[model samples]
Target: MLKKILFALIMSVFFIGIVSGCSESSDKEEGKGSGKQTVKIGYFPNLTHSATIIALEKGFFEEEFGKDVTIETKTVANGGLFMEAMATKAIDVGTTGPGPLLNFYVKNKEYHLISGAVNGGAVLVSAGSSKISDLKDLDGKKVAIPVIGSTQDVMLRKALKDVGLKPTTNGGSVELFASAPADTAALFVQKQVDAAATQEPWGYVLENQAKGKLLLNWDEFAWGKDSPNTVVAASQNFLDKKGFSASYLKAHKKAVDFIQNNPEESQELVIKHLKELTGKELSKEEVAAAFSRLEVTTNVNEEVIQEMADISKEAGYIPSADIKGLIDLSTLEEVSK
Candidate 1:
């Protein structure tokens, strides 16, 4: 009788262990749908990233991922650090432009473009020098840009080459310096740089506040009208294994829709978030002007991205980049449907 009771207790323990294992597996599946996976996002706190503010303020990401979703926002100094965090899986999602994204891909880092964030946010400005009006005037001139591989850099280089110039080479014509958009404006105001290419509201700040001259509005530059500026990118490993991209895209699309449908209200949200994120705010008109000049869409179309890549190459940021394969449009396509 003693032996039989001991055997029965052993069987009961075994049965409970199996049941607990099954329960744990079931919980993991439920947790994903329940928003257990933390979503980490990275971006710069700037007027150029107004879409991100719009999305966060409107709770678009939360709605798509369910009420339990947590969105952690990290503000890095520049796009290079932002992309670096994304590459290391320290960030689950990031919003940056094509130039750095392509550079990462060329280095064999795995990521996917889930959606478009903004467009037409770049411009080239001269300090107080009228001679820097056109690319020809850039000869031997010291110009500042945010970063070497940033979208602004790619476009600026392409625009320079269009006017028959190259960078970091004698007779190349222009000297490009690395500086933050806001800091670059200070350089312009101090006359330290002949010109600098950057995105708004820094451009607006320089022109409106500092008495600096606008050399080239991005639209008037090489690519013509705005090319996609910010893009929503995700890790390829995360997308393939977790299958969370569809949900993420749903959130991103919702963000674009919210921005479009509620411009004034959305502007207020962006302003509020920017103030909260950066401890400052721009005037209503400045925010409105920035919004009017920006295109917030998520269409990762091949042709447009390729144009950006071509621009990157011309700038010598990359020898070449395979942009078509870099985009995982199917994620957005499915999310849209």
Candidate 2:
């Protein structure tokens, strides 16, 4: 009788353990099957990221993700910060310049470029009294950029080198300062910096509000008309989740299409979103001017991006960049179809 009772208690304990294990396993499977119900998106508030801004403002992301999923958007100051956010998984996807994205990809292989966000909209601006009419004149002057190794910085450095100059950090005559575009605009307004290499609406603001001059339009820069200014990147883990990535890309495509096909409406949306993000009201004319300098699209130019990587390496921004596996346009292509 004692032995039977002991055996019965052992079996009861075993059954409980088995049931608990099954429950835990079921929970994990359910979690995996359900996937992430929320996605964190990171983007800059500048006109260069107009597609993302429009998507957020116009309900494109919500429309794509439906009411079940929650979308959280973060306005990052620069690509470097965006990359950091991605590193900690704080953001699932982000829009950033190819320069910083490439640099990040080289250091950490977890992020992938899924689509293009914007092209052009970057400019070299100088104080009105600086008389820096050309890149050559940038010699012996302090110039500000959004960041040290950003798209604008890489372009400015390469352009300066083409003009037979280099950044002071590179043992050249030109001094490079890194600051936010808004701050750069203020510095330009105060004549604290001789020039600023920046992306738009800030460029427009400097020209119109700060009385600055456009030293070099983006088209005339080293990368010329074909360069990609911003791209949509996602972590491999996020992409591996499946449904959300495709949905995000579809919404991205829609935003680009809306920008191209519905210029007037898109401009209004861009202005409204920009104002909300920056807390500074922008006029229709200013927004239009900013749009004129940019091409809102989803075309990822691989050759141009590769060239940018080369430029970044040559400029000593990155020791070397292996862009292989960095770009995965399969999702974008599938969404387009």
Best by lDDT: 2
State TM-scores per candidate.
0.85, 0.88
Off by over 4 Å in 2: 1-36
Cα RMSD, each candidate: 3.7, 3.2
RMSD of 1: 3.7
Task: Please provide, for model 1 over 1-337, each residue's C-alpha lDDT reduced to its tens digit, 9 standing for 90 to 100.
Answer: 9999999999999999999888888877655535476778777788667766766777776777665666677877677788788877778786877777777776665876778888777778787754556668887888888988788877777778778888874347677888888787667667788887888888777788767787887577556565767888777766774546777777667778888898888888888888887788878988887776677887655676777777666566677756656887777777677
Per-residue error for 196 in candidate 1, Å, reads: 1.2
Q: Which ten residues in a row have the lowest lDDT in candidate 1?
A: 29-38
Error of 2 at 4 (Å): 14
